[model samples]
Target: MIEEIPSEPVVITHIIHETPSIRTFEFSRRFEAQAGQFCMVWVPGVDEIPMAFSAGNAITVQKVGEATGALFSLTEGDVIGIKGPLGNGFSPEGRVLAVAGGVGAAPLRPLVTYGQADTFILGARTAEELLYAGELAGKAEDLRIATDDGTRGHHGFVTALLEEADPASYDTICVCGPEMMMKAVLGILDAHGVADRGQFSLHRYMKCGVGICGSCCFDSSGLRVCRDGPVFTGDVLLRSSEFGRYSRDAAGRRIPF
Candidate 1:
């Protein structure tokens, strides 16, 4: 039976080591999750963090810092608390272009899987970090990769890949990646003569998964990312000078990228 994610720990029935630094934790059963929404994961004794579901039963994680390191160390049958499908989600329409950087593919994978066939430009530091390429390929009409190390496909940023794409071919672009990368994406879109009709995910410091905490708001407009969106259109992004410029930290202090 489908289960509701709860505050209490739930068993991780299986695990898939996607790459050296990335792993997928599979829960006992499927839980509802929209393509762009996230789950608040509590790693007992370590810390709580937000994760995006790659599939109903699985959430992919990149072992970056302390909390993620503890998350990746989890073995089969280990229980961890999870609560979500929270936040606004992406909705695909017409023709779509999806770009993902490293583990950012975790969320976009579901979008391509459930939506109409689309194209993708997935980038990472190296070939090994280019996540879900094989899985995403099956769902994508065109699959391209940009690696910083030139170990795989194009030897440049994903924005370079975006630059080469005929912007007119697709109705819109959707991106999720580093703040700097998304900022570069905006510049590329402007140069390509594409209207700011695209959409992208904005990652901010989120404490409460709900809107109670004011941590994830735009600097000026006060639009809440956790509630109003984690995904916003290019038009919305254009209005906020803070879109790719800076993000608030745990204490709500602006940190420039």
Candidate 2:
């Protein structure tokens, strides 16, 4: 039987800086989360943001804005609220190549930790900005790295690295990153005729983690991202016009594309 877990406010106990602009928050939760699932983290006085789980069963947050910045300022036992292990995550059932760009590495970490038939390709703009390299390198079968400034392993975009790889060697590909990067990867997958077999995590600015808010809705299928996915198959991704576009926040104001 599937046990239903209730969402509630919890206290944050720790914070770690994964990079200059990125930090990870450690929060206590009893619920078990799948690899790519995310949670809506609520700051008492600020807005709640959807963050992906990095460590299993723990909420790891990267400092990006007001809520996240407030989260980073918190100390041990600081009170915070959380709502879910929301959205679909990566399911690496076959030979998989997991690709992560910038902070995108966080959500994909769990799959690398527990799932099988996986390899990892991690990228950042610089060596200092690269997160989870050591951990992913240890867990993944084959690990590759790329940076925009030539400060790390390969000097180029991760998509360039993907283009050079043999797509047939892997049964599936999992990707998460900036919209442009994911879109570029998707294009490469298409040219290689492997688009149908890949999975992508769509990063969007979300207000309510639940479907009712409609803050994360995409017009193409009228799909609510919070309810339908933060993760989708490449074929499904291709069908959504909103994949590369910006979405609205709770205020119904346009963010940016």
lDDT of each: 0.81, 0.78
The true-versus-predicted C-alpha distance at residue 15 of model 2, in Å, is 2.2
Q: How many collisions per candidate?
A: 0, 1
lDDT tens readout by residue for model 2, 99-157: 88998888888877775536788999999999877777777888899999999889999
Over the full model, what C-alpha lDDT does candidate 1 score relative to the true structure?
Answer: 0.81
RMSD of 1: 3.2
lDDT of 1 by residue, 25-53 (tens): 98976778778888788999988787887
TM-score of each: 0.92, 0.91
Each candidate: RMSD to true structure? 3.2, 2.5
User: Where is model 1 more than 4 Å wrong at Cα?
Assistant: 1-8, 193-195
Candidate 2: TM-score?
A: 0.91
